[model samples]
Target: MPVVIPAAELGEFVTALLNTKIPDPDHARTVSDVLLWAARRGVDSHGVARVPRYLELLDSGEANATPELSFSGGPSGVTVLDADRAPGPIALTAAADEAVRRAQAVGIGAVGVRRTVHTGAIGYYTSRIASQGLVGIAFVAGMPNMSYPGVTGAAVATSPLSIAVPTAGSSPVLLDMATAGIALGKIAQYRNAGKTLPEGVAATADGTPTTDPALAKMPLPLGGAKGAGMSLVFELITSVLVGAPIVSSFHSDDPQGRVHRQNALILALDPAAFGDPAAFTEHVSETLAALQGLPSTGEIRYPGQNSAAIASKRAAEGIPVGPKVWGELEVAAEKLGVAVPVTPGG
Candidate 1:
């Protein structure tokens, strides 16, 4: 069972825990906000569930707490950021801000980030850009944790992609997804819950598909070759472009190489640069209306719509933390000498 805690309390608790390692208060808050944003929207796999793993990385010196991030301007509307092993949210937020700023100056802007840690919920960064009235796109690549379509072992990173488009309404249309059939964090969630994985989603060490969570070694691509191909292209655009290719550098042979290194690319476009902003918003709203009006057996909600609704509801009620996640949080809090947020019933 999961326990419910106020969203604000959860955020405060997470920020305090992160502050223990991350010296910069703003950086710690940014990381905590990103994780809690995912949790509030029901993306539990990318949410506070990752706190324990992040703590491990920080304690082991695999992830830098206060990295001196550097940025250099490229061609018009282009920028590259050297994360210097900083946490993903910190690097990503900086890149997104720069992208939005450049987009405001020009018609479009792109930012590349290299040598960052695990980028939790790429949508969070994109949606932030969208909230600033710009179209946002983001992609991230890391060390291989997923198998290539027909390969035996892990070959490529899951490689997530996210896009967000602003609309007249409060919520933006956002699409955030991984190339793998299931995210690595979701696999960990399944293992924690003692549940069997869905068939065809993962394979055992011997290269055979397995439903047993314990036996699952690597995740399969979403649509076999199609998803694998997208992941490869993402790696090229992100890692290779940023001069930090993860797949080529890290493999099972080099376990430590997989610790805390990733690359990301973000783009922002202003609708006003192309045409009238009002026209773009009207078109998007009409398209969404048309899609909703289409014949359907169930609810027809666009991407990010349900997530927005979930976030709102959870904000009013409370964020749900599963027993396993709560237990891990407790252990982390105790180790760091921080107090955990108290649940309603407990």
Candidate 2:
């Protein structure tokens, strides 16, 4: 069974739980905000269900609870951020803000982040940039757990990319995707729901494709070689460029090579730098409208269209939490001495 929780209450609960590990209230709130943003938009795979795993990371010293983040190489529009193993939301949010600031001044901004942990939903950072009326692009590279085509086993990370463009209407045009055919989070979600994995999307420990969620160990690349190549390129531009180099390090014999860490690149482009900013947004809205007006048997939606609708619906009706995730939250809250939010009728 699932429980329904008000978005506000869930956010507060998650924040409190996170604060137990990360004493900084602001950092905790940032992580909770990003997670809740995904949940409200119906991306439950990247939502609050991840809190338990994050707690494990913080507890095991895999992620720094309070990192001393620093920035360098920023005389121009490009900058490098050393996160000191900070949690993903904190590092990426700071990078997004810096990108926006630089873009406002120089028409374009690019920030490379190093030594961060799992970046949940890269779209959050891009959407943050888009909210400032700037076009945003972001990429994340992490430890490899996805399969490469014709490879014997897992060979690439399911690195994600996101782009967001401001529109005249409320929701921005957002595209958030991983290079893998399916995300590990989605596989976990299916396993929790007792559902089978989609055929050809995931593989077993031996790199053989499997439709059973429980048997799936890794996600296959999205378009065979195409996705694996994109993931490799993302790693090169983000991790290698940032001097983190997660892929090569993970495959090396260095004792600490397998340490979990991620890197990211965030870029922001100001439309005013090109032409009339207002006209650009208006044209984007017109383009979306034109696409939606096309004849079809079903609704024609752009990338962020259904997400906006789902956010509105979830905002009013409350977010649904599965039994497994709720139980994990309960255990964490109890351990942290935080009170769990009550469901309407649990």
Give lDDT: candidate 1, residue 80: 94
Candidate 1 residue 17 C-alpha distance from true site, Å: 0.4
Clashes of each: 0, 0
lDDT of 2 by residue, 47-155 (tens): 9999999999999999899999999975678999999999999999999999999999999999999999998989999999999999999999999999887778888
Give lDDT per model, in order. Answer: 0.90, 0.93
Candidate 2 regions exceeding 4 Å error are none
Runs in model 1 deviating more than 4 A are 251-259
- For candidate 2, the per-residue lDDT at 71 reads 96
Mark the 10 consecutive residues where model 1 has the least summed lDDT. 251-260
What clash pairs does model 2 have? none
- Residue pairs in steric clash, candidate 1? none
- lDDT of prediction 1: 0.90
Model 2: what TM-score?
0.98
